[model samples]
Target: MQNLPTSWSTPVGALTATGIGGVAMAVAALAVTADPAGRFLIGLAALGLLVVTALGLRQRPRLAIRDGNRGIVLQRLGGRLDVDRTELRRVRIVRYPRLGRRVPMLEIDVRPPGADDDRLLVFGRWDLGTDPTNVFDALNARGLVPPDPHRTPDR
Candidate 1:
């Protein structure tokens, strides 16, 4: 059997490239565009791209599985969440149709210590910089989550 990675994260290079592109676009829009409305629209789009890049950079190394199967750490906008092995209730891949293609997301259900209800955390391909199915398989290999009998192996 092949060994799988224990951690998954968004590519920093991709985000940095996007930020640079956004800056170039913004500059070009302001310097070359003669129409005020066109410049405003282009600038708005560039700003949005920069904002996304900033957020992505802020949450570097988005998800990681701790050593000894202790838990998984998730970094978000404001802070990080640590979910122990005991807290993890379920992990599965969910697929949804988008633009005539199926997009997969990894859904982790966890009940934190002293928490009465379970919270569902979803990570998309963009978040992991890879297919969620691959992450799911890695989690399964590490025995962090139980195997789903209903899920087909073809994925």
Candidate 2:
């Protein structure tokens, strides 16, 4: 299937947070319908409020990340994320046990200067994860990213 657009910001995230929060609230509300104790409903509403507030406070990003048939791209919006498939140098996993799961991330090297090239990139769900233009599969489709000898790795 085709992927969703890659570039994203925090407002979408806020909406999603609110949606989940709403669902939780709805279920909780229903659960407490016959409650003689108001504690349960209070707790549920508190949970929903927390989610809503958190989403509201998130920062909106100007930078957009995307994966194309060529490679993963990371640049300011309207600029390119995947210069080409070959631009995607590596796909690494950013591990955080506190987080629910391990997610694959793209380490794109669109420009060269090799090792000195420190353009850190990360993708996968947070709200933007559902996007069709992703970094991993796009670069992998073309095979490994070839080293650009014309460019040098940073010392």
Candidate 3:
């Protein structure tokens, strides 16, 4: 696997806040619930929150993209995916509605060397850091692939 730069993960402050809030709510719920059924439900909720908190910490977003001469390797939560440079059909910067705001994504459509259908790879800010647009610039820098006409160039 080609080494790639690591991107930012979930900020520590956010994770800390979640843990503290979940603990506080769990303690208060346990103390205040008088009925056994209500207490059990509250306990379950507390457990769920704790589980989510743990997952947030463990499965924090980590992205790495390796540009091998022949293809690009994307490493994320699931695993590594290889995208052959020759197979890439279209590359564009797209905006997606996220958290009530527009987030940029690098959308790559690949036909994968004789495949009838195309596979779409979407890379968001989380996957490529604050400016995914740089990816397009980098690919263009290689001087092999021409600029995509369908998408406007980033100014």
Candidate 4:
């Protein structure tokens, strides 16, 4: 239960994923137990999945309260994610919870090539990039990013 936070999805995300992963392992174990010969195949597949997810888990962002590059080039182990200041299309604190009626999610989606619509950067809601409710503050302080049209607030 302490594996999913309404404000940030870091520690909770990891724990929640692990929990589900354990459950999946148990299911596979059961399937293998019922079929002796097929057990090897399922076991091999599970091992492969575990290896992949473990590598991806290494890319979890740091929660340190400091200013980092406004836009970053993300990658997993060896794969690259398309993200740069120029590719940044929008940044906002999106709400995923309601007062006693819905669950919550803290995320900032980034759009990209062919991926016209997809979540880009997502950390926690209360966890901002910089001072106050201004994520731009983080970027500005970094002094490594340029003004992005998508980051402009609707005034």
Itemize residue pairs with steric clashes in candidate 3.
none
Q: Give stretches of model 3 more than 4 Å off.
A: 1-68, 76-78, 97-101, 143-146
Per-residue lDDT tens digits for candidate 4, residues 54-143, read 654554432222223435545345665546555655544444456765433324455676775766556444232222234333433444
- Give all candidates' CA lDDT scores: 0.85, 0.47, 0.62, 0.47
* 1-155 per-residue lDDT for model 1 (tens digits): 24677777778888988899899889977886578988898898899889989988888678888887788889999799888888988898889899999899899988988989999999998899889988887887788886556766664
Residue 45 CA error for candidate 2 (Å)?
17
Candidate 3: Cα lDDT at 145? 43
lDDT of 3 by residue, 1-155 (tens): 12323333445566677687778768967797568777777777777777656755664443333334555565545655566677768877788888999877877787877789988877665445457666655555543243566655452
Deviation of model 2 at 48, angstroms: 16
Local error of candidate 3 at residue 31 (angstroms): 7.6
Better of 2 and 4 by lDDT: 2
Structure candidate 4, residue pairs in collision = 96-104, 97-104, 110-120
Query: TM-score of each candidate?
Result: 0.88, 0.37, 0.56, 0.38
How high is the lDDT of residue 55 in model 2? Answer: 49
How does candidate 3 fare on TM-score? 0.56
